[model samples]
Target: MTLRLSQLIGGQARPALSEAWLDVHEPATGTRYALCPDADGEDVAAAFEAAQAAFPAWSTLPPSERARWLDRLADALETRIDDFAAAESRDAGKPLALARDVEIPRAVANLRFFAAAATQFASESHHGQAGLNYTLRQPLGVVGCISPWNLPLYLFTWKIAPALAAGNCVIGKPSEVTPVTAWMLGELAREIGFPSGVLNIVQGLGPKVGQAIVDHPGIKAISFTGSTAVGTRIATSCAGNLKKVSLELGGKNATIVFADAPRTQLFETLLRSAFQNSGQICLCGSRLLIERSAYAEVRDELVARAKKLHVGDPLDAGNQQGALVSKAHHEKVMGHIDLARAEGGKLLCGGNAVQPPGRCEGGWFIAPTIIEGLGPYTRTNSEEIFGPVLTLQAFDDEDEALALANATPYGLAASLWTSDLRRAHRLAGRIDAGIVWINTWLERDLRTPFGGMKQSGLGREGGQEALRFFTETKNVCLNLG
Candidate 1:
C-alpha cells in the first residue's frame, strides 16, 4: 500500500502547507513505501494556534468527561493492536514480536493508565494551628510533546496521554522518520470525537517545527525525548521564556554481571538488553561491566549467543533481529564499530553491516556487535552510540564496577546481575542512574517516575509525575481571625 501521511490540526487531517514531503521508507526492505509531511514552522504555528484556542474548553471540561475520552482512545488503539504493531515495525525497523507484545501494548496502557490517573488526581492539604493550607494543581494551557523515532507511538502517547489527562491541550510532533503509528493516532482521535484542537500533530524536522515549538510564547510546557545534544538545545531555547521543559535524553547505560550471578539467565537476558530494537532504546545497556572472576566465561557465552541471532526481515517470524531505522543510522553504527577498532578494542563478533539476500539486499542490517579491551573513558565506551554495539570491560570488585558504570556523563539507567540481595540494593542505591534494574532490564512500572540523572535528562515522566509536570501548583491558605 502506498501511504500518504498528513498532519493533524484542530482534530482534522491536512497536508502540510510547507509544500515539502519526506519519503518514508521500510527499513526492512529499503523500500520507499510512504510519504509524510515535511512540515515547517508555519504548520507548527498553526498547531499551536489551534491548541491555544482549544485550551480553555478542553482544560475546563470535567475531568470525568476527559477520562471517558481517554478510555475511548485506549479502546480504539487496543482494537487495532495488530495494525499498529505492523505499521510501527515497518516504520521503526523493530521486530514484529517486540512491537506486538511490548511497544503497542505499552502505548495502550499509557492511555488507560493516565485515564485512571486523571479521575483520582490529588492535591496535598495541611491543617495548621491557626489556618488551613490547600495546594491546587491546574492544567498548563497549551503544551508541546515531541517524541523520538525509536519507539514512535509508544513514547508519543507516553507524553500525550498525561497532557490530555491533566486537561492541557497538546501540540504533539512525532519523529519525522517514524510517523506512521502517530498518524494513525491522529485519525483515531478525530473519529473518537475528541474535541477539536485537543490533540494536534505537526510533522517536520527538529530544526524547523521543533524549534518553532520551543519559541512559541503560548506553549507553557514542553516534554521532549531524544539525544542529549538536542535536549541541551531545547533547554537553552526554552530558558529565554522559562517554559516548563521535561527531557528524556541519551544514555550509555551499563550492565554489571557479578561472579555469583546466574550465568545462563544473565547471558539470555543480556542478549535481549544489548540487541533489542537494535539497541535504539535510550535505556539499553551499551556497556557491560563483568566481574573479573567470571569475565572470560560470560564474555565467551555472550559472543556465542550474539552469533546465533538471526538478522533479516522485520516481518519474518524466524528472524530475531530487524533492520536499522535508516541507512544513515546504519552507517553511523558501522562508523562506531570502526572507531572502536581504532581505539584498540577487540571485535569479538558481528561488526559488519550485512546485505541479506533477496528483498533485504539494500536494507540496513548490522550484526549484533561485541567489543572488548577498551578503557572506560574511550570514545566508543563513553559516547551514546545508540546502536546494536556493546563494549565489554572487566571490573575487579563492586567499587570498580560502580566507578566504571558511573564514569560516563550519562546517568540514564543500569542493570545489575547478582545473586547477592544485599549487594543488589547497596549497588543499586549507589549507582548514579535514575532507573536501576536488578537481574532484569527494561522492566518498567508505569507509575514510577522515569528519567535520568546528570546529562541523561531533566525532570521525570510516568504516573503522577507526568500529571504534575503538565500542570501548575497554587497554594491557598485560609487564615483564622
Candidate 2:
C-alpha cells in the first residue's frame, strides 16, 4: 500500500481540502512509495489561520515555557531516530548511513540548539546618563518556512526549530519531492501533544501551496531555501507587503588547493567536498582551483577517486553514492555535463549515467564527472550544476586563484587548502564568499551566522541572526528627571 502523507493543520494530519495528491518517489529505486497532498490555496489558508490563531498565546508564553516544548519535541524525535533516518534516505535518495549518522542527528541538534536558545534568548539593554534604554526582540506572529529537497528534515528542522524556539507560530512547507520525513515530524508532533495550531506542515507543489504561503497577508515573515529563481520570486512577493524574508539560495562554490598543502589530507577532504551527496549540496565545491605546481597531481587523484565511487541503492551500506532526488534532476545534471563538452571542456572521467545492478537498474544515478580545460567564465564552471559534476581550473599564483574563486556570481562558500597561515588569512578576506574554510570544507558551527553574499542569497540564518530575523525589534527608553 502506498502511504498518503497529509498536511498538519490545527494539530491534525488530514488530506488536502482540494482532495488532490502528488506521487512521492523513492528516488533510489525510481518507484512511488507514497502520495503527498497537493495542497492548494485552501489548505494554505487553513494553515495560516491555524498558525495565526495560535500565535498570540504561543508568543506571549515565557521563553522558558517555549523552550520546554521544543525540548520535548527533540526528545520525542530522538526516540524515533531509526524511523526518521530510513524515511529521510528514501525520500531524499541520500545514503542510509548519511541520513542515520549525520542528517538526522544534525536535525535533532537543530531542535535542541534552538530549544536552549529560547530560554537564553537575550535582549539588548543600555544604561543612559539619566535613565535606561532596552530593546525587545519579539517574534513575528505567523511565519512561513519553505525548505528545499536536498537535506530534507535536516534543513526543515533548521528553519522550523529556530522560528518556533523564538516564539513564532510556523506554517512550514517541505519540498514535495522529500515530504515523507517532514510528515513523520508532524506525526511526532501530534504524538507529543504539541500545542494545537502552533506548527503546521503543508506539503505540495511550489506553485500551489508555496505561493499561497507567500501571498497570504497573515504571514509576517518568510524563510526559504531553494534555487535562486524561486527565491527571487519569493523575495519579490514579500517586498510588496514589506514582509520580512530570509533566503538561502544556489551556489557555485570553489575548492582551492595550494602546492604546500598536505597531499594525503587534501585529497580525502577534497573528494568529500566535491562529490558528497552526489554534489547536490549548495555548498559543495563544484569548482576546483588548483595551484599550477599541484594541479596535475590533484586532478589525477580526483579523477581516480571519482571513477571508483559506487552508485547504487541508498539502503546499501557499501555504496558510496545514491541516486539523484528525481529523474528530472538527473536529466538536468546530464545536460550540464553535455554542455561542458559542447563548450570545449574535456571530460577527464564520468560523464555518463550509471545503471546499478538489481533493483536500482532504473534509478537516476549519475557517475561523478570531472571536466577540465574549462576557463573561469565558462557556463559549466560558473553555473550551478547541482549534481555529481566538478569543473577543474588551474591558477598560476595566489592572485590568480583568488580571481578564479571569486569569478562566479555566487559567493556562498569556498574551501582553501594551504599551509601558509598568512596567505590563508589574506585570501580569505578577499574571497568574496560569505563563508571561507581553510584546509576544510562543510564544517559548520551553528552559533555563527550562515548565509550567502551577492546573488547567492539575502539575509542570514543560524545563531542569533536567525532569532533576530524571525523577530521585530522595539526600543524602550525611560527618563528620570
Candidate 3:
C-alpha cells in the first residue's frame, strides 16, 4: 500500500510548506515503503495556531459532551483496527499480530478508559466557617506531545487520550521514523468528529519541529516519551516557561528469578520480557538477575527458549520476532552483544544476527542473546541497551538480588518470580521501580498506572493518575452571604 504524508492541522490534512521528506522504511526488507513530509518551523507555527484557536472551546465544553467525542473516536478506531495494525507494523517494525491484536486494541481501550474517567471531572467543595472552598481541576491550555518510535501508536495514544480527556488541546510531534502511524491517527481523530485543532500532528526532526513545540509560548504543558537525555533536554526547555512537563524516559529494568520460582514459567516470562518488540521497550527487563543456585539451570533453559524464537518478516504469522527499527539499530544491538563478550561476560546462547529461513536477506534482524557473569556496574549491566540483548548476572541471596536490581541509574519496571507470597510482597516494596510484576513481565492493563522513578521517568501514565498529569488543580474560595 502506498501511503502519503501530510500535516493534520485544524482537523485537515494539509501539505507541508517545506519540501523536505523522510523515507519510511519497511523493516522486514529495509525498503523505503513511503515518504513522510518533514514539517519545518512554519508548519509547527500553524499547528500551534490551530491548537491555540481550539483550546477555549475544548476546555470549556462540558466533560460529558467532550467524552462523547472520545467515545466516537474509540468506535472509529475499533472499526479500522486492521488498517491501523498493518500501518503500525509496517512503520514501527512490530509483528503484525502484536500490532493488530495487542497495540492497536490496547490503544482503543485506553481511549475508552480515559473517556469514562473524563465524566468524573468535578470540583469538590467543603464548607468552612470563613468561606466555601473548592478544588478545581482545570486543563492546561495547549499540550505538546513528543512520542518515540518503539511503540508509536500505543505511546502516542498514551499522551493524547488522557490529555484530550482532561480537556487540553494538543499539538503532537511524532518521531520522524514512525510518524506515519501518528498522522493516520490524526486522520482517524478527524473522521471521528473531533473539533478542528483539538489534535494537531506535525512530522519533523526533534531539533526542528519537536523543539518548536516544546519552546512554543502557546504550549502550556509538555509530555515527552523518549531517551533520558532527550527527556532532560525537553524538561530544560520547559523550565524557564514553567510549563507543566511529564517525561517517560529510559530504563534498564531487571528481572529477578528466585530458586523457588517455576523454571519453565520463568523462562517464558524472561523470553517475552527481553525480546518483545525486539527489546526496544523502555520497560523491557534487560538485566536478568538470577539466584546463584539456579544460575546454570536458568541459563540453559533460557538459551533453549531463545533458540526456538522465529525471527523474520513481521507480516508472517509464523514469525515470533521481527527486525529492529532500522539497520543502524541492528548494528547498535550487535555492538552491545560484542561489547558484552569483550567485557568477559559469558555468552550462554545466541549473540550474532540470524536470518530466519525464507526471510528477506536485507532486513535488520538480530538473534535474541543471553550473556552471563556481568557485574552490576559493568557497561552491559548498567546501560539501557534498548534492543534484543539480555544480560545475565547472578546473586548470592535475596539481599544481593535486590541490590543488583537497584544498581542501575533507572528505576522503570521490574519483575520478580518466586512461589513464596511473603517474599514477593516484601521484595516488591523494596524495589524502587514504578511497576513491579510478580511472576509476570510486560503484563499491562489499560486501567493501571504505569511509569517509573528516578531516570526512568517523571509522573505516570494510565488510570486516573494520568488524568491528573494533564490537568492543574485550582483552589477557589467564595463567601455565600
Over the full model, what C-alpha lDDT does candidate 3 score relative to the true structure?
0.87
- Report the Cα RMSD per candidate: 1.0, 0.9, 1.6
Query: lDDT scores for all predictions?
Result: 0.93, 0.92, 0.87
Error of 1 at 348 (Å): 0.8
Candidate that beats the other on TM-score, 2 or 3, i.e. the better one: 2
Point out where model 1 deviates above 4 Å: none
TM-scores of the candidates in the order shown:
0.98, 0.99, 0.96
Off by over 4 Å in 3: 128-130, 356-359
Compose the digit string of candidate 2's lDDT tens values, residues 264-383.
Answer: 578878888888899999999999988999888899988998888888888999988999999999999999999999999999999999998998888899988899998888899888
How well does candidate 1 match the true structure in TM-score terms? Answer: 0.98
**Best of the candidates, lDDT:** 1
Sliding window of 10 residues with minimal summed lDDT for model 2 = 124-133
| TM-score, cand. 2 vs. native | 0.99
* Least well predicted 10-residue stretch by lDDT in candidate 1: 260-269
Model 3: per-residue lDDT, tens digit, 1-481?
Answer: 6577888999999877877887888787788888788788899889888988999999999988888988898899899999999988888777999999989998888788888889975667889576899898999888888999999888888888889999999888888888877888888887777899999999888998889888888788888999999999988988888888888999999899999997656777788899999999988899988888998888888889898998888898988898899888888888888899999998877788866556467788888888887788989888888998898888888998999999989999999999998999999999989999999887877678888899988888887777888888998989888
Global lDDT for candidate 2?
0.92
